[model samples]
Target chain A: EPEVTQTPSHQVTQMGQEVILRCVPISNHLYFYWYRQILGQKVEFLVSFYNNEISEKSEIFDDQFSVERPDGSNFTLKIRSTKLEDSAMYFCASSKDSNQPQHFGDGTRLSIL
Target chain B: AQRVTQPEKLLSVFKGAPVELKCNYSYSGSPELFWYVQYSRQRLQLLLRHISRESIKGFTADLNKGETSFHLKKPFAQEEDSAMYYCAVLGPGTYKYIFGTGTRLKVLA
Candidate 1:
């Protein structure tokens, strides 16, 4: 079965530095999403992308955060300046349509020092 | 606001015993609920969805409108069933999902 793939299974960066988490969604999926889970917390939605634009975003996805499908296959989340609270497991997901089941990647564990 | 509630943080059951993981949601319109399971060191995967009304891996969940619950249940728990379970609801129109805190199940041999 085709699955979403994320690069750098784990990332460690200094505070105030820029960080980019990359994901390659399922080949034919149309909708892509990003979600994060703080240790021992529920998964929180970050943003969703479709049609080459952001469709929705949460409060946590503030000015410092941005997402782009720079290429037809790569979906990347960039944080201009990292903070301690930004440390979490980031999961990327994709679906054929908005209402279809979203398949998730293994997740990238981001740690800010 | 749409939210999913999973009251129990952890549950333990012996092999061969019955198990149930509770989940409740708050939504005004008709809701779509799902159960997602994450095994150790594995990515989160969809276990079942209310719309399908089907059983997978010997587990089943029924969406109760009056109670506003979609609890996962297994007639006989197995050791492999141990994992973290999350209850989620698809936001109406928005296509976003609201997930619960999750319940960690430990099936002892």
Candidate 2:
């Protein structure tokens, strides 16, 4: 099975610094999404992208957060200023289409210091 | 508000015993339900979906529209079944999935 792969399984960034989380979604998938799970909390949806633009986003995806499909295969999530509350396991997922089940990546564990 | 709820934070069952992980949702419209499992440090893998109505790894979940529940059940549990399971719902007008807090199942040998 083609799986979504994320880079830097663990990331430690200083507060107020910019950090980018990278993900390579399934080659043939069309819809991409970003979700985060804070320790002991339910997984929260961040943003969903399709046709090279954002289709939907949650309140947690504020102005400080942005997502881009810089290329055909790379879907990146950038945080302009890291906050302590931003520490969590960030997961990237992709599906063939809106109706298909999304396949999730291993997740990047972001830790803010 | 649309939400998925897994009341039990943790459930333990001995090998060969039956297992049931409860899930309930609060969605007015017809919703798509799914069960995803994460083992140890692995990524979330789709165990089953309500639409397919297929059994995967001896696990099955029925969508009870009247009860607003989609509880996962397995006739016989195995040690390998121990993992974190999450119930998610996607409503008619949304592409984002609302996930439950997740239940940690520990199947003792």
Candidate 3:
């Protein structure tokens, strides 16, 4: 079965540095999303992208966060400045449409030092 | 606001025993509910959706609008059913999903 794939399974970055997490969603999927989970917390939604634009975002997805679909297959999330609290497991998901079940990637573990 | 609640953090049952994972939601509008599971070292994957009304891996869940709950159930559990399960809901007109804290089910042999 086709699945969503994320790059840089794990990343370590300086507190003030920028980090970009990349994902390649299922080829035919039309809606993409980013979610994060603090070590012991529930998965939290960050943002959703469709048609090259953001459909919705949460308060957790503030000014420092940005998402881009630079190419047909790549969906990337960039954090302008990483904070200690920014360390978490980031997951990328996609669905054929809004009502469809979303498929998730293995997730990228981001660590801020 | 849309919210999903999975009351149990951990549940353990012997193999061949019946299993049920509880889930509840708070949403004003119509909600689309789903159950996602993650086995050790594996990615989170969809187990079942309320709309599909289909059983997978001998598990099934029914969307109870009156109770605002969508609990997953299995007639007989197997050791391989051990995993973390999450209940999620998507409110109408939004792409964002609200996920529950999750329940870790361990089917002991």
lDDT of each: 0.96, 0.97, 0.96
Better of 2 and 3 by DockQ: 2
In model 1, what lDDT does residue B62 have?
98
lDDT of 1 by residue, B1-109 (tens): 6789999999999999999999999998987899999999999999999999999999999999999999999999999999999999986687678999999999999
**Residue B55 lDDT (model 3):** 96
Question: What is the docking quality class of candidate 3?
Answer: high
* Per-residue alpha-carbon lDDT of candidate 3 for residues B25-70, written as tens digits (9 for 90 to 100): 9999898899999999889999998889999999999999999999
Candidate 3 structure, TM-score to reference: 0.98
Worst 10 residues of 2 chain B by lDDT: B89-98
Instruction: Give stretches of model 3 more than 4 Å off.
Output: none
TM-score, chain A only, candidate 3, equals 0.99
Ten-residue region with minimum lDDT total, candidate 3 chain B: B1-10
Q: Which is the leading candidate under lDDT?
A: 2
Interface RMSD of 2: 0.5
lDDT of 2 by residue, B1-109 (tens): 7889999999999999999999999998899999999999999999999999999999999999999999999999999999999999988767798999999999999
DockQ values per model:
0.86, 0.93, 0.92
- lDDT of model 3 at position B67: 96
